[model samples]
Target: MNAQAFPPIPFLDLKAQQARLPGLKARLDAVLAHGQYILGPEVHELEAKLAGFCGAAHCVSVSSGTDALQIALMAEGIGRGDAVFLPAFTYTATAEVPLLLGATPVFVDVDPRTFQMDLASLEARIATVKKAGALRPRAIIGVDLFGQPADWAGIATIAAREGLFTLDDCAQSFGAAQGGVRLGKAADATATSFFPSKPLGAYGDGGALFTQSAERAALYRSLRTHGEGTTRYEVLRTGMNGRLDTMQAAVLLAKLEVFEAELARREEIARIYDAALKDVLAVPARMPGSQSAWAVYCVTLPDEATREAAKAALAAASIGHAVYYPRALHQQPAYQPSHDGAALPVAESLGARVLALPIHPDLSDEQAQRVAATLIQALGG
Candidate 1:
């Protein structure tokens, strides 16, 4: 069949998901009826469910994924003169949080195949920071890029040796797992987003932190609500108003009912793309002994020219496509001044050539096939 035979495909079909969620309206109505739009019962309920789903001991809900990272770092006393390490290929939020917290971000290269932080690069970067002696080597944030788990086992070993705190930036990978266990318990602390496009997203901006420590959980709860002590008015320390909205929590709870099934659908769609497109383009490489949430199914072209050509072709075909990150964190203008002069070839190359195709629970088989065929044609197959 020709590409013109298929109708336009939405990058993410939230309405389709809403239609499948039978209790969505009731959940929203409950929030309205309760009249507790702030940190209400629904918020706690969602937090519990989220924690349980990931097999984590505690889940602290926050206003956004950025706030989750901030609160986690705050609890660890990360500030000026502290060196925070993260991958250069991930979203800005992972790097932004460190800079916003008055810390320096030591960007590291990523693996060409997995698009994950390179453990060797991470070790070398840590050594570079230690040798510099100007900044304290404080933490390592291993991002689960594109909904796939990072090498947590390798990251943990490095962190243990370097005596650095390990923060799992699981914003794109909450539902994912590593070594048969869910992602939440892989690091010292894990942060995840609930943006509408995420696998387990809320209606609006919301996020959460997961941990196995009761002490860290208590600190997170306090930090999220203005650092309160035993009493609400008694201030224990400086904090931010990062509470998740009750309405958003209500929405998440409704969505959570269908999350498992939706994840399965996403995996199915990803498999379809893998089988169809692998021969033509560089498909995403899954982590060993792990399952991804399949947030964004991206493919890498041979070079920048090939990507531009593909982009033009996809646009002409009316296919929904996007570049996840056009620039690595080190190349972005905001971080250029702070970025140490290091050539991260893999991250830079990925930023230039990668393009994401539509992959969601609502995408049909015909649409998936059309996407693959259109992309292959665009690549001049």
Candidate 2:
């Protein structure tokens, strides 16, 4: 195939996102004129809008998604031998924050289909930890994987029973909801990212934390800026430098205008992909009464060999594809201790077969159709 004949589709197209930038230039230019780049007016404006969108009382903007998690943990005072339960199937950052805070990340299996934390497994893990009488069960981090909100009601119920704080990792499912309740409002605190490729991305790295408690929100603000209570020099608590930049905040504020439209378009694209690929692959299962943001349109191939073959075929046909995570976080080098002597059949299996297809607001119907056709053809469906 001639490269010019069919231009390769990318997993994400930031250039297409750039075309929407002009709408915010006037607001951005005004910020530039004021020369107040850090903690500027736009920062509060974006935070307020995000808090309203998530139906939360407070939103604290931070430097990155990783920082958002770190701040949330700090605000909750989860540290020093505290045990934070997390799904073993998720990204490393979900578990890393706990370790960084001198806490232990207790790995739990995920629901085989939804790829979210398995509530039964989570409760079992918590009980086992308590029985051990060594580690303290302090919190649970429920990740909204592939843009679908986790079983928040179930997870939250378990957390409340165990007196554990819940942090909703909305990094991929910021706009998602279950039973009309948004992800941010589902947990004690919600953390989301704006890592350029996210559904509501900024120009660069950015993230925000949402909470309903006034005291927690105030603490998070202090944690984001090196724990300053009143003055910059006064350190009330140990904290990280996690302030979000003004420029990224400005870009996100502009992107917020069309976020709902883009979410709807993503859903349409996902439906098309699901219908076309269902016969050949295991399509993502949408839970009842839940709406996903569809951050990634992922499918599970029949096996590892078929997954590799399909990826090669997509490459040959100029279709874009990626593996959201080829390796489970528990299997990573840094998290070896957590995975030691643990057997997670579902997480390991999904890591071998899951593949993400090109999905974004910019993907045209024709492109989506082509991606579907190429996958089916590759799999000999």
Candidate 3:
């Protein structure tokens, strides 16, 4: 067989997405003509559209997803001596934001099946934190990992019982839903990213914060713009330069027009993978009464060695494969000092066994089938 016979598949097909969104050029052109590169009309337009899309009362555009998280925390006055509980089996941004704000991150283990933050583990961590008396239990940063909604209802119960503020780290799950309710208004505040590879991505870095509280919304707007009160010169509080530029907003508004169709296409591709690969491996478990954004299609092998072998097979087949968070956040070098040496076995296991396959709207059913076939052969199934 010719090695060149295998077609290249992108893990994130941004070029194909661009081609599908024809209004992108026009949106960008409008921004260019307006000459208001910072916080222009497009920024407000994108914010309104995003808030309306998710039923959030307010949406404040930010420079990036990380900034969205930071801004949300700052609004709540979460800082030194406070403990922010979050899942271990997630991207670094979730854990990093708390630590950056001079608070400690309590790394809780995730549920083996759903891969979302385990509510039991979360409750236990809160109790332990209160018992230890080292830090104040201030907030629960519930993450919707890999485009799935964290059991927001369960998390809400835990947070209310413990008097902790809830922030939905919805970076990968902006379009996702739980019990038919969209993600943005699930928590007291929700933060979403528009990084180029995200389901509703911009041409460059962009993000938005959604909240129902008008006061928090005003605080967020002020904080993102150097803490300006009524005027730019009048500083209300210490803040960061976290404004979303006009061009990215323009690009996102254009992409937002087609986001629903793309999400449907992604769902169709996930079904293709599930239908072909489910019996052979541990396919993703569907959460009851929930819809995933399908940002990643991950299946676990028996162990690390098998996962490595499968990755090699994928590479040989010219298919893109990745391991999300190859290490739990607490296991990383920087976090070792803060991590209380708590055992998160499921998080550790997930880090070793999970393999993310090619999943994006541009993937054809035939290509998805090819990926499944290659993985099955690699597993000797």
Candidate 1 lDDT, 1-381, residue by residue in tens: 354765778788898888889898999999899899999899999989999999999999999999999999999999999999999998999999989989999999999988999999999999888888999999999999989999999999999998999999999998998888889999999999999999999888999999999999999999999999889999999999999999999999999998888888999999999999989999999999999998899899899999999988787777889898898999999999888898998998898899999989989998898888888888878
List model 3 lDDT by residue over 112-167, tens digit each: 87898888888888889999999999999998888889989999998888899999
Clashing pairs in 3: none
Q: Write the per-residue lDDT of candidate 2 for residues 1-381, one digit (tens) a residue.
A: 333567789899888877876778877887899888999999999999999997999999999999999999988888887999999998889999999999999999988778888888898888888998889999999999989989888988898899999999999988998998777878899999999889999888999999988898999999999899899999999888999988888899889998998999999999999889888778999877999999998898778999999889888887778897888888888998765356877888888999999989989998898889888878887
Which scores better on TM-score, 1 or 2? 1
Clash pairs detected, candidate 2? none
lDDT of all predictions, in order shown?
0.92, 0.89, 0.90
Candidate that scores best on lDDT:
1
> In every candidate, how many clashes are there?
0, 0, 0
The runs of at least 3 residues in candidate 2 whose Cα sits more than 4 Å from the true structure, single-residue gaps closed, are: 1-4
Question: In model 1, which regions exceed 4 Å deviation?
Answer: 1-4
